[model samples]
Structure formats: C-alpha cells, structure tokens
Target: MPRTTGIRALIRPLRQALRRRISRWITRCCGTPHPRTGPLPAPGRILVCQSNSRLGNTLLLIPLLQGLADRYPHARIDVVIKGCVHGSLLQSLPGIGHVHELPARGAAPRAMLKLIRELRRLHYDLAVEANSLSTTNRILLAGCGASHRLGFAGPDQCLRLTHAVALPSVASHSALQLLHLLTALPGRAPASQPTLAVYPDAPTRARAETRLRRALGSIPANRPVIGFFTRATGNKQLPNAWWQQWRAALHAGGDPPLLIEIVPPGGLPVHADQAAVSTTDLMELAALLARLDVFVSADCGPMHLAAAAGIPVVGLFRATPASRFAPLGNDCISLDEPLHPVVVARETVWRYDRRRDTRRSA
Candidate 1:
C-alpha cells in the first residue's frame, strides 16, 4: 500500500509535466490564436483572473477592470478572485460585475478542469490572465476554451499568449502598464489617467471624524494635517529625537501633531484620546481614512488604499523603487530617501523627492 501511494504521487507529477509539455508544443507549433468569433463583434462575457501577490497589487487592478468594462460595456465582466474575502473586496469595489470565488491558492488540476467546464458553459468570449505567465497560467488560458487570451509577455514567453502586451521594465509601475495593455488592444485607446471611485457611508465618515476630533483636540484643522506613518520595512520609524525635532518645528509654526496607530482588534499599544483603529477591516479603515484631509504613510498597503480613496498622500519610500510604488495622483506625494543619519522635516520631505517639483503654492 505504501509503494502504491508513492507510485501514485509520482504518476500525478509526471502527468502534470506531460500535459504541460503537450500544451507548450501545441502553442509553439500553431501559435496561440485570437478569438475566432468571425469579426469584431461584441464579446458575450469576459473573465479577469486574479493571482496578484500583494494588497497594493490587487488594488491597482481596479483601473484595469474599469478599463475593460469601459471598452466592453455590453459584455458581462466577471472576476475570478483568489478567495471569498478577495471576492468580497472586488464586489465592494466599483466597476465590478460578477465575483467568482477562486481557491485561496491556484486551482488544482481537477478543480481547474471543472472551472473550465463551468466557464465553457457560460460561453466566455475572452479570458485575460493578468498575472506573470507560468506553465499553469498558460495551461489555464489555453484550456479555458475562451476564444481569446491576453497577457503581458517577454521575448521568451511571448508565444503563450494569443495577444501579448510588451512587458515594460521593472522600474515602471505595474498598474500603469496594465492599463496600457487594455488600451493598446483592438478597441478604443484607454484614458489618460485611470481613477478609482469609492463611496463611504455617512455614518462611517462621521464616526471617523469623531475619532480624529478626540485625537487632535483644539488643534487647528487647516494647519496641514501632516500624518506620520511611523512604520516601514525593518523599523523605518521615526526615533524620539526625530519626533522631538518634529514637535519643535510644529510648535514653532503653531501647528499640532496627531499620531495615528493601529489598536485592539488589529494591533494595540493603546493610549488616551488617540485616534486608534484596525487595519484588518476595510470598512473601519475606510471610515478612519475618509476623515483625514491628508494622509502620510510608508510604502505599504495603506498608502495605496489612501491613494485609491483619492486622498492626498505623502509616502516615505526606501529599499523598493518608488517608481513602481509611488501614488500617481496630483494630491499624493512620494518621498524617496534612505533611512540614514536622519534628516526629517517638512523641507526634508520635499527635498528627497524628485516628483515634489511642483511645490505647494504659498
């Protein structure tokens, strides 16, 4: 029985390999073909697949989904999300149609096959695999029975996609590049800037405002709500001396500081009258964020969330290239600097960033 189990495991891997090899051979020989629906008729249905690695990555996908809908207004756009929670996020986000829950990970062979069968029954006109091309993604796209498959590919992986967008350098923001792929297709070119829309309930907004009021009691509201996100990769937080200097600067300028932190239900180092909240719940976070006039954060998920919410953001970026992570909005500011022999001030924020050229007019 033990030997039989071992043999069975080996057979499964071998079978997968053989299937992959066959799929590749077919793609290389015949070349991946576009949808054969005769002409440029409107697609019946479209599926956008999610296999992104991070929260910011997933958030960036919003515009691409919007662009797809804009281009194919008649088509029912469905998103295959990686989890039930992920599907819920997509459902809450604007510009989404149907949200199909995918496994928390990649679909198993049997599961994938079943999904393909279900998709076939729906008669999808196109499937856009919006992830890095792997043997699995290639197989999934080829096997899904969609007439068209689109993806970004390099010189080596070009053949696997029916229509491949030229993958840009890693320095470029993946979100912007993804938008290009949608626009560069056979339809109308995409808009100049992609935007995300969110509508927070009034009560939630009020609650968030009440919390902020308690945190910054008697502080002038117009004094540039300079939020400090004191966490980053490997403790890029502001030291006591830095805070001391910050306090000195603010006091000299008649401004007050409002320190934000995660508290119970998420993380806690609770203190009195502090505007603490959880990051785990989007609704709670959204409420807290809606109350902020301006937000400052590290190059983390919260930063992207703030940008998506159309809030003015200032991001302190280190290690990662700011190009890929910077919030591309007029109100958002990205400051790229190494955590060093510390020099931090309002001036320091502007000095470190090349993008901060358009100074706030006096």
Candidate 2:
C-alpha cells in the first residue's frame, strides 16, 4: 500500500506538468496580442465568457454585465455560459444581446465545434474571461478570435490575454474579483458596490402571483410574507428539524407571518404542511421573490436571486464564509456562526419591521 501511494503521489505532478504544457501550446497557437497602451476602442461586439456551471457563480456575473453596459452603452454584449437556466436569467438583464449556451463537458464534440463556429462568426471586438484561474475558460477565450482579450494575470493564463489585471493577493468577494476585469478597459469608471438587477416580465409576474395564490391562499395586505429556502447545492443543506423549530418559533410571536417555502425544481419539500413553491423557470422564481417581504436562505443561488429582486434576505452560512458569499445590498443579513432557531426567527421579523418603519418614514 505504501509503494502504491508513493507511485500515485509521483504521478500527480507529472500529470499537472503535462496539462500545463498542453495549455500553453494551445494558447500560443490560437491567441494573438492586441496593443495595451492606447485607450480602448468602443467595441461593437463583446463576448463575456463565464463557463462555470454553478448557479451562484452565474448569478454573480450580473454586476459585471451591468458594468459593461455602463462603460459601453452601444456595444452588443453577448455571453457564453454553461447552463440554459443561466442563459434564461441573463436574457432579461438590460444590455444583453445574446446568450450562447455552451455544451456541458463530455457532450458531443460536434456540438462544441458548432458553438465555436457560431462564436467565430460574430467577430467579437472584445472578449473578457470572467473566471479568475480556469484553464478551460482561458482556452476558450484564446480561441475566440476577439481583437482584444481581457482576463486576470495568473501564472498560467496571463500570456493568453492581451490585457490582464493583476489579481489581488488578499481574498475578496467573487463579485469584486470579477469587476477587476473592467479596470483593464480604458476610460471605464471604478465599479460601485455590486448588486444584481433582473427584470421579470408582466406575464411571468401574473403567473407567479397565480401560483402563489393557489399554494398559500389569498395574499395578506398587511402581514409580511417571508420566503424560506431549505435546500442548498450539497453539504450546505440544513436539517429539516432545524427549519421546523424556526417555523414554530416564528409563529409563536403575535400574528404569524405568511411563510412560503421556495424550493428549486428537484429539491426536497421543506414539510408536508408548509406552503411550497417549486419551479424550473428562473423568471417565475424571480417574480415570486420580488413580492416577498423577507427571504431566508442558505448560501445558495436562490439567495442571490432574492437579493437581485430587491428583497431583504437573511442568509445562513455554515460551511462558506458569509463575508465572501453573502447576498449584496444593505438589506441582507449574514449569519456565519451557529445561532438558535429562536434567534434567527426574531432577527428575520425585526428586519421586516425595520423595513416597514423605514417605508412609513419615507
């Protein structure tokens, strides 16, 4: 067993070296340098590559998209993303012209070739790789044939980019890290606090309201509606018992707030008696989130969605740092340490009450 372990350890560095060599070869073949000294030209066609499939990462790109729109109002901004759900969410964002969905890894080679052809046909003036240090994303950016390519100045991928921003030595929020790419563009202003903005259409809002009415009965005019998200992607999930305790405590105070469980399409239901709403559609989910007075969720994609819809969110974090991944906006509260269910319930209620008071004062 010791011999086998030693052999495996020796093989790991060899594999990494081989991969790095191949990446460098590909970049040298496909990438060309554009001048970095002069002021950046106003691009007519822009391609933003964020090939990560995780929903949270995709949602975080909203601020970068907004930044690009502000910098170049006339550019036709296109995005190359990994999932159809991400494409749908981005479609409604202002200044987005097209959303190109990349086939998942191990998909048919023909599909990848077809996507490459389509990207080349656009003849993009500029391409920005939003991921910090992804070899695959770097390769895609190299092959995109954009006149100017922007990305981070990492050891592996810096040579592939025409203009690369030096990555910060200290850790920062993912949204702030992505905004670093914008600094490479000449004449672009410094990015403000990152916040996602999504606009759901009227028809989608009507449908979402109908679904909510069916599940939770009539909408209360005066009572605060609190939305709870129980499931997260993996180990981030909280136990059902934890939620049950919180729900019970929340109701113990005066008149109970209307609790709506927001479940993802294939996620487990919070409780048999709880009013749960599940949907695969992004806009419908956004529409539902927009109406909620407060949203309580784990550090998950839907948590970002609720924040984007301008709802106050109470984000519970256990595995990840709330400092880095907490929902944007002043209305968000992030609890990183373990707190009692009663405490969580009270804090959520207090946030809603404060919001109400502020609105009244306004």
Candidate 3:
C-alpha cells in the first residue's frame, strides 16, 4: 500500500503533463485560419492573450495596452488572462474594454471549453499572443479564431500566426519587448517607451496617503523616506543578514534616511521592523509605495510595482537577468550579479539625494 501510494504521487505530475500536452494539441488544431501577409486590418474588437498572473507581468502589459489604445482610439480591447482577481487588477486601466478569465493549462476541461465558447461568440478583428514564449498564449491566440493573429513566433507558433514576429536574440526589458509587438502591425508603429503603470483610484490614493503619514510620523520636507522590501519569491531574495549589512552601510554616513520596511500579507520576518506596514492589495501596495522617496527590493514584482508607481527603484538581481525583468523607467537602477550590499545602499542614497536636490531646485 505504501509503495502504491508513493507511485501514485510520483505519477500525478506525469498525468498532469500528459493532460496539458493533449489540451495544447487540441487548441492548436482549432480556429479558422486567415493568414495575412501585409499591414493588419483596422481592428474593431481586439483580444490580447497574456495569461501570466504575476504583478510584474500585469504592469509590464500596460505599455502594450496603452499602445493598442493609442493606435486604435475606438477599438474595444479585451484581455485574456489567468486569475479571477486579475480582472480587478486591470479595472479602470485605460483602453481595456473587457477582461476574460481562462482556466490555467492542465485545469478542468469543462471550464476551458466554456471560456472558449464565450470567446467564439464574439467576432474579433485580431487576437494577439503577448508573450513570445508562451505556448498556451499561442494556443489561445490561434484557437480563438480571429481573422488576424499576431505573436513573436518560434518554430511551433510561426505557421499559426498571421503576423508572426521574430523573437529578439538579445536580452531586453520585458515591458519593452511587449511594446515592440506593435511594430509588427501595419501602419505607423507606436513609439517605444516605458509605460509600466498602475492607477490607484483617487480615494484609494488619498487613503494610502493618510496611512503613510501616520506610519511615517513627522519628517523634514527634504528628507527622503526609503522603503525596503525584505521578501521576494525564489532565489532572488536577499538574505536577512545582507539587509542588515545594507542598513548598516546606509547609516554609516551618520545621516540615516527614514527606512520603512514593507511587509507582505502572511507575517513579518525577524529582519522586518516592528512598525512595518503590511498590505495584500496590489494597487494599495502601489499607492503606499508611491509615497516613498526611494524603494529597494530584490528582482521581485514589487520592484516593478514601485517603478510603475513612478518612484526610483533599486532592483537587486541575483538569479534573474536584470536586462530582461528590470524595472523600466527613468531613475530606476537594475543591478545584476556580484552585487555588493554596501554598493546598493550607496546607490540608493545617491538617487534619493539627487531627487531631493532636484525638488529643491524646482
């Protein structure tokens, strides 16, 4: 019985993989093919497939949304994504007319079929596979049966794509790459710029302001408040001791800026300050981060979040390539490899000081 149980557990993953393969094959086989070779038709109802559920990916997706909206002022833009909560994450984001929640790969077939049915009911002028490498996104793009299909194509997806774009060999910002997809379309291309942004509604921003002031207590007008994110997923997280060293280095100058430790939902770790603020809401977190002078974190979603909030972000990259996932904007630092904690502290201080001086001069 024990051996049987163990084998069952081991084979569960294999079964799941087989299910996903079958599902992908089914998706690729579906859809009406209208292979266009020139400039795309002026789209009325468009679908964008970016099923990644992470905050960073959501933020990175904003530029493409903005560009699409700009290019087609009157087009109805619909986004197909993964999570139910993601609908709210994209709420009030300009240019997005609808958000479609799809079942993740290897999930129940019933839900997937229902989503596909709903999608087919609407006649889309275009469907886009936003991610260059997402086979699932390619499946959604092709299988959705739009007259035009666009994506950065590999060998598997190129034949299925109507507007197939070659994937860049060089590493570049994720946000920028998504924006580059617009260049593949017919007509004048949208200018490439960092458009990573999250809108905290007016009331939410006001509430966030009040909370931050209370948490911040009193400080001089010129003093910059530094927010430190101690947590990150995967191997990109900086150790608690490294944070300690970074903090010590910041204080070595005898003028320690106001440091606010940003805590996540679960619980605060040993390294976090006792008075640290915690919030699970992504937009609320962005609102809170907007109040900071400078935000620093490992190459995590919040680093991108802070950049989206229009603050100077110090993104410390340990495992991931900063070139690909680094925060995209002016005044953002993307430090890759062999990172010295003290050096990061110095750089953060320099950005804070530069901003303070600029504000004073203004």
Candidate 4:
C-alpha cells in the first residue's frame, strides 16, 4: 500500500508538470501581440464568446450586451453560446443580431469547424472573450480571425489577447467582470444597473397562462400571486423538509399569498399541499414569472429569470455568496445567513404587502 501511495504521489506531480508545459506551448503559439493603448476603431461586426452552459452565466451577459449596444450602436453583435436553451433566451432579447449555438456536451468537431469557418467569414471587427480566463476560449478568440481580441489576462494566458484587462483584486459580480472587457475602449460608458431581461412573445405568454390555470386554478385579481422555485442544480438544492417547513409557516401567518411552486422539468415534485407547475421551456417559465406578484428562490437560473421578469424576488443564498450571485434589482432582497422559516415567511408577506401598498398609492 505504501509503495502504491508513493507511486501515485510521484505521478500526480508529473501530470501537473506536463499540463503546465502544454499550456505554455499553446500560449506561445497562439498568443497575440501585447495590448496597445488606444481608442477602439469603429467596429461593424462584433463576436462575443461566452460558451458556458449554465443559465445564470448566460443571463449575466445581458448587461454586457446592453453596454456593447450603447457603445457601438451600428455594430451587429453575435454571441457564441453553449446550449440551445440559452441561445433561445438570447434570441428574445433586443440588440442581439445572431446567436451561434455550440453543443454543451459531446464531441462536434465537424460542427465546431463549420462554426469557425462561418465566424471567420463574418470578418468580425472585434472579438471579446467574456468568460473567465480560459485557455480554450482564448484559442477560440484567436481563431475568429478578428484583428482585435479582448479578454482577461491571467499569468499564463495574457499573450493570447490583443487587449487584456487585469481582473479586479476582489471578486466582482460576474456581470461587472464581463462589462470590464470594454474598459480599454475609448468613450465607453459604464453600464447602468445590471439586470436580466427576457421578453416572451404573445403565444408563449398565452401557453404559460393556460398551463398555470390548469395546474393552480384561476388567478384572483385581488390576491397576490407568490411563486417559489425550490429546486436548484447540484448541491445548491434545498431539502424537501426545509421547503415544507417554509410553506407551513407561510400558511400559519396571516392571510397567505397565493402560492405556486415552479418545478423545473424533470425536477423532484413539490409537496402535495403546494400548487406546482412544471415547464421545460425557459421563455415559458419567464412568462409565468412575469405574471407573479412575488417570486422566492435560491441562487439559481430561475431566480435571475424572475428578477428579469421584473417580479419582486426574495433570493435565499446558502452555498453561494449573495454579493456575486444574488438577483439584482430594487425589488429583490438576498438573504445569506440562515433564518427561521417563520422569519422568511414574514419577510415574504411584508414585501408583498409593501408592493401592494405602493401600487395603490401610485
């Protein structure tokens, strides 16, 4: 056993060294010239590389897109995304010219090659790598054939970018980090409040309304519709018991808001007592959230979606930091520390009532 352990330890260092050497070689071959200080040229075709498949990561690009639109009003912005669902979401937003969907999983060498050819043909004036410091994305930016490439400069990856900006010492919000990609450009104003915006078409909204009515009865105009998203991907999911307790507390409190549980497609069922509606389509989900008076969720994609829909959201953060991942907007409140179910219930009710009062006053 000791001999095996010693051999394993020796091999681990060897593997790391090999990885470092390969990384260095790739950087040397692909790295662009060091960044020059100057105002950006008028760009006609802009390519943004953000290939992460997670919904939150995709939604975070809204602010960056808005900023780019403001700075280069004439530029046709195209995005390279990983998942089709994210592409669909991006398609709904204004200012987006085209969405280039890359497969989130599995090998698609031919498809990728085709995509590269298409990108090269576009003759993009500027290519921005908006994801974290990733070598693969840097290589992809280099292949886009844009004379100007922008990205963050890590110790080993700075050479790959024509314009490399240093990341902030403290971790900033993901949206802010993405916006920083434009800092080197002249006359680029900072983006206004970073918020996700999803616009569902009439048919999609009608479908969502019909589904909600079928699942949770007709909505009463006077009653506040409260929506809850109890499931999240990975370890970010809250326990069923926790949700049950929260529901019970809400019911026990004074007149409870009309509760609707948003169950993601293929997600675990909510408690039988809670009204649940499940949908696979992101735009359909956004449509439903838009109709709600208040939405409560953990730090997840849907939480950001609800915020985008302009619904009041009480975002609960357990594993993730509230500062970096919390839903943004005036109507949103992020609670990071553990709180009693009754306290959460009370806060939910208060927020609902406050909005109600404001609407009446207005």
TM-score of each: 0.73, 0.90, 0.87, 0.90
- Model 1 lDDT vs. the true structure? 0.60
TM-score for candidate 1, residues paired by index: 0.73
Per-candidate Cα lDDT values, in order, are 0.60, 0.82, 0.78, 0.80
lDDT of 3 by residue, 96-125 (tens): 889998786688888877777778788889
Which residue pairs come into collision in candidate 4? none
Ranking by TM-score: 2, 4, 3, 1
Can you list the residue pairs that collide in candidate 1?
Answer: none
List runs of model 1 lying over 4 Å from the truth: 1-27, 30-39, 106-114, 133-136, 158-160, 201-252, 262-265, 269-274, 339-362
Clashes of each: 0, 0, 0, 0
User: What is candidate 2's lDDT per residue for 15-81, written digit by digit as tens?
Assistant: 9899877756654565322223346789999999998998888989999998988888999899998
Q: Write out the backbone clash pairs for model 2.
A: none
Candidate 1 lDDT at 288 equals: 72
Cα deviation of 297, candidate 2, in Å: 0.7
lDDT of 1 by residue, 248-318 (tens): 55445443445555433545433343455554555546567655556666677667766766666777676
In terms of TM-score, how similar is model 3 to the real structure? 0.87
